[model samples]
Structures are given as structure tokens and as C-alpha cells.
Target: MFESLGFEPDWFGLLGREVLRERRAALIAEACAWSVGLSDRPHHLRLRGRLVATGSTIGDRAATGQALSGEEDGRLELGDARPGSFQDALNAVDADGAVFADRFDREVIEPFVHETCVLAADRARRTRPGQWAELLDDLGEDGAELGDVVRAGEWEQPLRTDAEHLVLAALGTAPLLEVEAEGLPLSLVRAAEATARAAAAPRPEPEPEDLSGALFLALAAVREAGLPAPVPADDAPRLLAALAEQGLEPDEVAAVLPHLDLAPGTADRVAALLAAA
Candidate 1:
């Protein structure tokens, strides 16, 4: 399936995994930053001081002028009458940390997966009519990217999972290239879905590739979705080079097409799109 769109599943899988890992790392970093900010609070400093005072007894035992060594008490002791406050502070920090982690996991990580999945699915249904379900099924069938995304719950897991989802979504349902085939691009399909969803329109089911006019509509939709209009005169090689500059390949580019399943005419249009770009 991916081959038709110009991508090798294996390479794309690796890329997907990397993207997932990176995303999780970013989320974790953001959480850590929040933790750092909390740690800077005056309340935390006061609490820490109390904890040190209560926990420590070394000062009492150590010679007045002797340097305190780790071998002596194995832990630091604080001055009298402050241990309780310090303990309270430590507890607060711990609790805050837990909450931060939880929020990142649920709020940022989970929602990202759902949004990316929905976007991918919407595009698939538009581009690969009569095949969206099958493509989605196949993505999850062999424990490919789709399954990985669905299994993601943590930072790294979700990011990797999303990568899989993106690849699967991109390649999910490209229409065959044919003289009479539609020329829809994946981007267009996604845009249309977004529009429909916004309007509360009943989501359209995938349709079989029919008139060539669909290609124009799909291309227009993609443009509306933020992609540049199709280029003219660029063949596979030039297009591949251009997309490669954007960290993509011909196959990946093909997967982005909603009407890739069409015949030579549609293929030529794609080539032209690439060339013009």
C-alpha cells in the first residue's frame, strides 16, 4: 500500500518511532520546567530549611569546629524546631510533581494522539474511498504504526505511536491514478473533513474513484488545507528532490495524494504539481 505512494514501510516506521520519542521527550521537558518553577517558590525554600533542621542531629554531636563529614551521620541535620515545616514542604513538592506528570500524560499526550488520528483518518477516507477502512485495518493488523499509536500512554510511547499514525494516515487510502480517476490529494481530504466536521455535516463515507473532476476539487481542498497548489512539469525525480529537502521522499509524496490510485493522467497531474512547486 505504501509502495504505491512511494514509501517503504520499514523506513517510514523508523521515522515514526523517532518522531514519537521526540514528542514524549518534549512533553517531559515541559513538565520538568514546570517543576523547576515550582521549586523556586519561597514556600519551598522555607519548607526545605525546616526539613533539614529537623532531620539533622549531626551538629549536636560534631565537634564545634570540626567539618561535618558524610561518614559521620550519613545525612544532614537542620537546627532545632524546624523539621516539621521542612517535612511539609517535601510532601508538597512530591505531590506537585505527581500532578504535573499526570496532567502532561492526560492533557498533552492523550489529546495529541486523538487529534493526529482524527486528522489522518479524515484524510484517508477522502483520498482512498472504498479503502479507508481496509487501510486503517491493515495499519493495525500487523502491529504496524497504527497499533503502536493506539498503545501509547506515556510520553515516548505516545509520540512513537503518533508517528505510526501519521504514516498510516498518510498512506491509508490513496486513489489509483487513471486517465478518468479523481485527482484528490490527501491534504484536501483532510480539509474537507474539517469543514464538514465544523458544519456538523454527516461525515461522508469513502467513495470509489470516479470522475476526473474530483481531482481538481481535491487539489483545491488541499490548497485550502495549507499546501501549495500542484506544480506542473515536475517528474518523479525532481519532485523527489524537492520533497526530500522537506525530509520526504517520492513515495511519501505519493502517499500525500488523495488520488494516487488513479492511472497515468492523474500521475501526470501529480508530476506537474511537483514541478510547479
Candidate 2:
């Protein structure tokens, strides 16, 4: 039970076991329906694990969609329904990890599927006389151990493995993300769509870029936003010595050049250099 969901205690004992399961199923539906529209991953995962534990299936398609964000074209955000203010307060913005994940999925996950399929067909031709097969005939026929054909990184392997299973089930009863129609692993769809999104996103054009200058400005913002941290006593003397070696005198709030000269910008520059380092 997510306390953050804010369900009334009066309703808790009022609902029977069946009703509770239904409630969990509904939350799972809402989460899956919203998918990436709900931007809280840790909470989402927690809620999802709970929901799945309650004997409700999100289904293969919905589960796959949850593994990655779906089409943003028609997504309606869950404003107020799922509070994002807490995560917003973290004040951190870094998409490099996501970008790298996308690349790894695209470059690694997709290839494993293709190579595995081709080599499996070749192996079937060589050893087991069979009708034409795409993914290993053993995939459908028996629970055979996977050969060391596709070398997938651990980061993307679980998703790729799930996607491979989905590919095997693509033509069967339930609907899917149409990834198999193009003969691709379901997992690769996430990477492909992400690539498309990245392409469509507006990018900042490089102009008269001063990376160090930007770092300096960013350092100022960090200092303002952050709690005052103690500078290490041991390191301060070393930094002063370094500054002296370059023929400048260092102080806590100010610095001097030899023969009565004040270096007004030196502190900020030194801070920026530390940040750059």
C-alpha cells in the first residue's frame, strides 16, 4: 500500500480482500496507462512490484510498454493525481544516463536478436533437419540452453531476453507493439523510438561557446543553491601553494599579485578551475 496514494483509512477495513485486489489492479492500470506520463520511477517500480504481487497481470504488451516510454503524441499527464513536486525539489537534471541507455539498447539489444536469429537458422540447417525457422527452433520446441552466440551487456540483457520471448509470441493471441511485424525484438522498439525522439527533439546550436565560462557560472549557481560545505584544511594549503607557484598570493576571500596588486577575479576563476578539474 503506497501511503502517498492517500487513500482514506476508513476505506481500508471497509474493502474486502477481493476489493483490495481490484484496487491494486486499478492502480496498475492507471500507472501503465500513464506510463512515462508518470515521471516517478522509484515510486512507479515500487507500486508496480506491489501490484504484480497481488496476482494481476499487466499483460505482455503493457509490461513491455512499462519497460520503456511509449508514444508521447497522445499522452495526458497525471497532474496532481500523482504528485511530482517531491522529485522536482531534487533540482537535478541529467539525461546523459538515459541517452547512454538508449544507445546501448540500440547498438547492443537489436543486434543480438538479428545475429541470434540468423545463426539459429544456420544451426538448424546444419544439425537438426527442419522446416524454416527464424529464432532458434529450440526456442519454441524445447527449453534448450542458449548458445554463446549473442554477447549482450548485462545492462540491456534482461530486457532483450524478455523482448526475444515477446517476438516468439508476437503472432499469437494477444496484441503487441507491432515490433514483431517488422521482424524485430520487442525490446529494440524502446531504443528505436527513443532514437526517433532524440532526433525530433530541438537541440541547442553550438555558437560562440565558452565551456569554462559556463562552468564558472554554473559553479556560482551551485554555491548559491547548495548548503555551505567545509573546505578541507589540508587541501587549502596545497591550493595556495599551487597558486603561489604560479606567482600569485592566495587568501580566503582575496588574492594578491606581487607588489600591491589585488586580483579581483582570481577567487572565482580558481573556484571555476576546481570545478573544471
TM-scores, one per candidate: 0.24, 0.18
Which regions of candidate 1 deviate over 4 angstroms? Answer: 1-99, 136-277
Q: How far does residue 243 in candidate 1 sit from its true spot (Å)? A: 85
What are the C-alpha RMSDs, in order, of all predicted structures?
Answer: 27.3, 24.2
lDDT of 1 at 230: 47
What would the per-residue lDDT of candidate 2 be over residues 1-277, giving only the tens digit for each residue?
6477886342211222223233333322221222232232321122322321212222332333333221211112211111122111111111321221233236544564444433443444455444323333423533143332222212224435544333223322222222222323333556578899999999998784334433443334334433223323333434344444444322321322121122454445555555554
User: Alpha-carbon error at 56 in model 2, in Å?
Assistant: 40
Put down candidate 1 lDDT per residue, 5-32, tens digits, no spaces.
9975643234435444445544333322
Name the lDDT of candidate 2.
Answer: 0.33
**Which residue pairs collide, candidate 2?**
none
